[model samples]
Target: MRLIKTGFCSLVTAGSICGCTGPSAEKPASEKYNVLIFTVDDMRDYAGFLNGYAGKVYTPNMDRLAAQGVAFTNAHVTATVSCPSRNAFLTGLRPSTSGLYNNGQWWKAALPDIVTMPQYFKNNGYYSAGAGKVFHHTPGNNPPCSWDEFQDQVFDDPWYFQDWSPEKYWLDFGYRDPKVPMPDWKPLNGIPKIGNNDWGAIPGKEEKDYGDVQIVNFARDFLAKDHDKPFFLAMGTYRPHVPLHVPQKYFDMYPLDSIVLPVIKEDDLDDVPAEGKKLAMEGNNVFVKIKEYGKYKDALQAYLACITFADAQLGAVLDLLEKSKYADNTIVVFWSDHGWHHGTKQHWAKQTLWEECTRIPFIIKIPGAKYSDNICTRPVDMVNVFPTLVSLCGLPSMEGLDGHDMTPLLENPQAKWEYPAITEIKVGNVAVRTENWRYIHYFDGTEELYDKTTDPNDWYNLAGDEKYRDIIESHKKWIPASFAKPVPSKEKYYFDPGTYTYMDRKTGVMIDGRK
Candidate 1:
């Protein structure tokens, strides 16, 4: 790979700062490009450009990236939860392949030697760094060796800034009370009490007070520094995830009366398989409780507000990147770990093999690429991200990755693609998504099929139909030949965030420590 000089200096020209006198000046055609990845949590295709929500959500920043890049309109994740889905993206493997199916599973414990996306870049001379919720927020999830520099995981709640101490922050933020259990979600004005399920607008707090703001600031500072080697920077934002709290201005963006809730059919779950139904009700049944209390619109408003707030933070980082010297030489990728459910199939969260829970927002902007403002409808998975980045930046190919390079699709959005996007919720439960069909195969051999052309909401199941038998058989071929049993968790090991180590629950032996 081409290498630049060790030192560089900046030059100011007519209100613009440019790096001209150094390795940046005589850049080689073979020089590797910088990579910037933005991973958002619990975000679906609610952006205005996706039109998945009938253009009701306000996501100008996300839409802006789509305008300047190629948007994968039919992208899906390998798993629906934060940990498993992110693992798939970083390792280019399905959850079954990695043996990490749920948020409780740790990647280091399951696949200790796996080369992550950032780790791969670091191994090939690039400086890798990340901040915020890049990996699952559980202790030991950040994988210190994967990054050259990783900011300590931040969980700052924008609504609480009364003190720097965790105890005071929790108490002042209404997470603790003398009369009841801390974080107990009691009904507030008829709203159900689910931990971090409530939403509101916090006034008078600057954006920097929020955890995401700190993440962006860290990324901005990284971009401002002159680097001889290419950089791989990851900025993960948590919002629109839960405890939907944002500045009041974002809440005002969507008036309660004007908020539009997702359409839910009374018999939406009728055609879903028993396994699918079980997955739908995995959580606290937040959707049912909210509907019973007649607060669906209010909940929807909070979610939209959080999404807007997240979008604003993204805009700030993007603005800074555009103004930086690396703007023309960087590739920006923005994606969500997984999708969220909003009353679809009476489901409230991810961890299901359905459209609402599996589909995600994926966009990539490669500088000097031929395509822009293009939308690719071909089915793609989050696994494709790793190989795609490696290929785009001219990095040496790594072995045994499940995803294929997406450079072909990036060059030509309308390119023919035969492979379908696969999403596995558990060990044996999986879904195959093609351009026009979604076929779900559960662990117990139960199945569900929906034709997007006829049922965009996935309201009907055609798996049992005699005419669709051939189609079902064809999709089943995409399932893995073998399954990897889930690695030991819960009982075998527990994490200690204070020490950033994983200890064996029984022996108290430290199994893994942060690098």
Candidate 2:
């Protein structure tokens, strides 16, 4: 296996493989460094350099990941939904491969052979510690399985005990409006009384408290703990997700007049096939009808505020690391489970093939890696998290993994990379993204194609536009190798017949999970 190196004098001509041929080619430079993976629940590539974002949202901590490491503008997770998207990342398997398609499902039933990324870290002499939402709904239940110790920074589950503090509580407890929420609210509570306490971030000040502080507080303490050897810390943050909750301070960071919603022409859904239109209209089941630009802007602003809070929280972790003995030797990898969609084609949240939904923000900062302040637009799938780290850490690349080693791109930022990544939604919908093209295969034998080069907004679907069939054919060249695994019955991914996920581990399978 060869790795790519930046600034190398060698070049590849018309027909040659310009690969590993330097002293750095021996093994991964990050082998012995401690690992810290900072994952935001739902975020976009709006950090700093990704540039096309429409907000005043600036992530200095996220910028650190990109400036000091590699920022992947073209990275994507398999699903936009939480549970499945995360299962794919941790298991090194696609949602299709792992049989994790919806938040309504569990991974253990269909894919018990899987070992989570942290589990892999724990297997080898690392003291793994995790805080917050690492594996979606599993939340606090993540068991110190992969981690030596785990704690939920927020309330027990999705709702927190501190809900009464934020304004969102007034909405759930005050105004129960689902479709339309008030555009205005007061941030009377301001900051939490406990400086290092863990709480959840609900959209406005009322739903859930800002959870970033809670998660990062536990994470920083873990980093400062006495360690006999290297440690692996996983910090999961649920922000920029929905019911968007953040402190009034973060919300104030971006004024309403300063917000800009995506441009959607009246004919935006014209090219979309009937089925794609159906799904888009359903908005991944979370939303039914499309809200006007004004409503979405407010919604998106809340999400962005959560991101801002998340950014500052990330700084806390980085601050503790810079002060710790392991500062220079630890490797930090930051990513979001999946990208989000805020009224693009009338969709919000995850579960769409659009770039806004599938593309995740990935940043890797190895202690002494060759790349820095580099933006690799090369397409990378969520599955690659497995093989990339394994190779970089000098661990044998796992056998039968879905992703390839990304070591080369880290070095040769603009190398002739492979084709686009392939992601699956349900069994029938498949999306492929090459450098400038995005193609989707829908469930009703319908296909949606967009010439990303010409249609950045994906306003025009080119699937049936016979004139562009060649470009569509080109994207098809990299159809993922299909496996013949039988689809598990929907019953398989559901909670065990008599089990309550909230109960103690010893009481694992008995409450029917019918709450």
Candidate 3:
């Protein structure tokens, strides 16, 4: 692991060769930083730094990384969808301890031991990498010992695309076209006229023919090279997740008669809970056919023009990480593997448990974090981004982690958490959320709650209000006591992909998909 390459006069005279300091000093507790995660797909809390959409959504590089730092505003996601919320925050663990509740299961066929979060930053030395759509791209669901390099998930796709017309040919890639019509052309009454749930404005694709602009131009050429270890990179963009296609100047920056939609409430499921109205009118309810075909302001102006074309590819990867050379020791972060539901509880996407599919848009920053714009508001989780990047990069604390140490909410954004985030989506379904309550429960026992400081869009349910029954038994003591058993899905296993292993579709053997 001796790759070396130091600079800026060996980071200002390597104080005893490792406690180096220079680029504006202060980092030297044996130096190692550089992480930068940035994931975004199916983003929610419609960023202008999480105002969760009141309308005009532009994002300015996630509001300049939430004004450079802390911004948690009660983040969440233990699993809401997107491969069980990115396999429960890259295996900090919880789809009921990795049974992986859907996007066709396969967290290495249900926890192949489990290390992940870039294989624990490539088992400590760090130089991980990664690119578009981080995991759950299927065929073996990513994992090659969790990246020392990764990058080609077809670089996320769409360099060029067209063809869905012969009566929308079953929306192509997912097969289906046998003379169409089996619930094919719906056009908007809850919207699913076929796959990737259609949206428009792709006239002449540009912003470098996106696939998140080749995953932010491979994270701006891996932050302009010259690094020797201390990297981890990870970009993963895949726009507002779906055919919300972009470019027409981000669909002329969301026009369709000035878009705004989402207020719903045709009695917002009346007092909700028959398992939250069977997950808001059940099976593909697509906001009750996008409020019965008015196209809910043309699918909310194609999801705010694919979220301002994924925030101009996250302002061209944060303007190449503030013009590279690991911009004063990188840590960055910016999240979003969950939280979407475009029509609030009438639901639209992200396998609901709610708070618009588990809140999201987390944001971190760190590089010399003594706290900047800091927000926090308590209730954390995203499996506390794997033990808060192993206690902010000092490393080494990995035994059965179920998330904690968010470095005291990134150095006190009013820290004192007491845990409430939770989430899940199946197997005894959950939810939780806190910092003013949300609860939920489902899986037949049925419940719901919501108070969130006087119902911030959770629209009041108070779970049979017997004075909130000790706040629903204290958020049901944080759910998951035991669940696990679900696995067999990358279509019943098989895998191999050059021996990354897996097989077992009824014991045809193989299994060992690494740890």
lDDT of 1: 0.77
TM-scores for all predictions: 0.87, 0.79, 0.33
Shift in Å, residue 187, candidate 2: 14
- Give the Cα lDDT of each candidate: 0.77, 0.64, 0.71
lDDT value for model 2? 0.64
Model 3 misses residue 172 by how many Å?
A: 30
Write model 2 residue lDDT over 236-350, tens digit each, in one string: 7767665455667777777778887777666777888776777677553332322421244555566777788778878888888889888877778888887777667767556
Q: Please say which candidate is ahead in lDDT: 1 or 3.
A: 1
Candidate 3 ranges with C-alpha deviation above 4 Å:
1-33, 41-198, 218-220, 228-238, 241-243, 246-268, 272-334, 342-344, 347-355, 359-387, 395-418, 422-437, 440-462, 473-515
lDDT per residue (tens digit) for residues 1-515 in model 1 = 11111111111111111211222233333366799999889988888888877537889999999877788899998888889898889889887787888776778755677889998889888999998888887566786778899987677553333333345432422445444334332333345345457677544557668888888889788989989889999888889787786777887888878877788788888888888888887763677777788878888888888888888988999999999998888889999988888888778888888888878788998665444337899999999888777766655567788988776676667877889999998789999999999999988889998999989988889988999999999999998877888887644676666665677777776745455
User: In candidate 1, which residue ranges exceed 4 Å CA deviation?
Assistant: 1-30, 158-192, 494-499, 503-515
Q: Which stretches of candidate 2 lie over 4 Å from their true place?
A: 1-31, 139-143, 156-209, 284-294, 370-373, 480-515
* Cα lDDT for residue 442, candidate 2: 72
